[model samples]
Target: MERSTEFLSDIDMVVGPRGHRRWPDAVKAQIVAETLVEGATVGAVARRYDMRANHLSEWRRMAREGKLVLPAVTEEPKFAALVVRDDVETTPDPEPRSPLDLIFGAVTVRLDAGTSAARIAEIARALNASS
Candidate 1:
């Protein structure tokens, strides 16, 4: 190989201060919420967001501690109509009936028979939103 001491002058320089980025609380909450989804892992979520897993874990801890509030991931109505069977007997029975059961995926909530429709709707919406 012949020794050629020619200088290559073509060079591109990127000049910017490298520092820690400040993420908005809303953005942080959104990212944390993604980790809460079923079958989502902290490492996977962090990688998807181009962040460190430990940092995401810290944010999750903050959420648990109530220091950070995650926005509800619901796009539907907050309350739903509670439906009752017209065939339900209005007269008092000799035996107390079982509590009203609200099933959401793997979770089941038992509400009293006298529970208000609004309250039942609120509980159902909450359960549906969580899932």
Candidate 2:
């Protein structure tokens, strides 16, 4: 391959006081909230806004701790109308779940179908204690 080096442009970002960026609280909150959308990732949001992933993660943590506040969505929630036709048959959304078998190091815990989280924790603790 022949070596060909071309000029690449750099993004011009305004450095705020003390050589650090001074993002407004609202902007930070918006960026953090974008990651909260279904199937959204911190890396994607960070890349879209051209900022560090760590910073966005930190902002999300701050929002969780009530340090930063995200603005409420202006649009009202809308739900798609469900349509039914006599010619069409409807199937159940999900089949009934079967019993669960959890296997750990030298231990196996079989749980009844639809076991609650609290019961699972209790079983785990009991198993750990017996060992």
Candidate 3:
């Protein structure tokens, strides 16, 4: 007597008899993108996607290490403070004026008691241009 053999399909291999929802690749990619590239807090993203923040963090770490590939996204630049000092020692005075002061000395514009709005506007524009 010959015996018949049966093989399990792809769906059966992924999902067993028990009903369980496995995380899809797209969802994992989204979590990584939002947490890493977008600079969103893992907790916030987790809450939005209804997943644990710890899990999302792990995925982010893995993606950073090249274990996974997340969608490309832009990130903001981080800045650091730098201090530079010169050999010249200059004391701070109550008033300090640069060379530009001599080029454009302070000019006072006096108007009579009855100065028209247009004339005042023109004077203001001229002053700005001089600067």
Candidate 4:
């Protein structure tokens, strides 16, 4: 009974500082990634990290949104054995067209991807002045 009590006492470990425990993005991402392993559970991972499952979930969400940088794997990634296929289309497809393109009667103004509205307006004014 005394041994059981002693063991139980040791189970509760300090999570961190008393109030709000602020974890760095990198650490959160690493812990969140641990939950993705084959047999790992959120609850178990959270407990190991001394955090709540809900908090761990939030970290996972951050990772999904690219707010956190996941830790890199130590081992090189493995590739499947290359098998020669008979009907696989190996031809490289042509690159897709620009995302933003404006055409004003033969005047094809191909805007670069992520072209700002201000730049677009400037282009429009230049075109108007020429005509």
Question: Evaluated with TM-score, which candidate comes out highest?
Answer: 2
lDDT per residue for candidate 1 within 63-94, as digits (tens), equals 99999999988755467789989998687666
TM-scores of all predicted structures: 0.45, 0.47, 0.39, 0.44
Each prediction's Cα lDDT score?
A: 0.79, 0.77, 0.64, 0.74
Runs off by more than 4 Å, candidate 1: 1-16, 75-131
Task: Rank all candidate structures by their lDDT, best first, as comma-separated numbers.
Answer: 1, 2, 4, 3
The TM-score that candidate 1 achieves is 0.45
In candidate 2, which residue pairs clash? none
RMSD of 2: 17.3
lDDT of 3 by residue, 1-131 (tens): 54222221322323446834365665577667877644578898777655578988888888888877887666568788887879879888655433221122567666664566787777777888978
Write candidate 2's Cα lDDT for 53-127 as tens digits: 998999999999999999897657779999977997778789778889877778877888899999988888887
Tens-digit per-residue lDDT, 16-94, candidate 4:
5664555666567777878888689999987775568998898888888888889876656778898988998788977
Q: Show the colliding residue pairs in model 3.
A: none
RMSD of 4: 12.6
**Candidate 1 vs candidate 4, lDDT winner:** 1
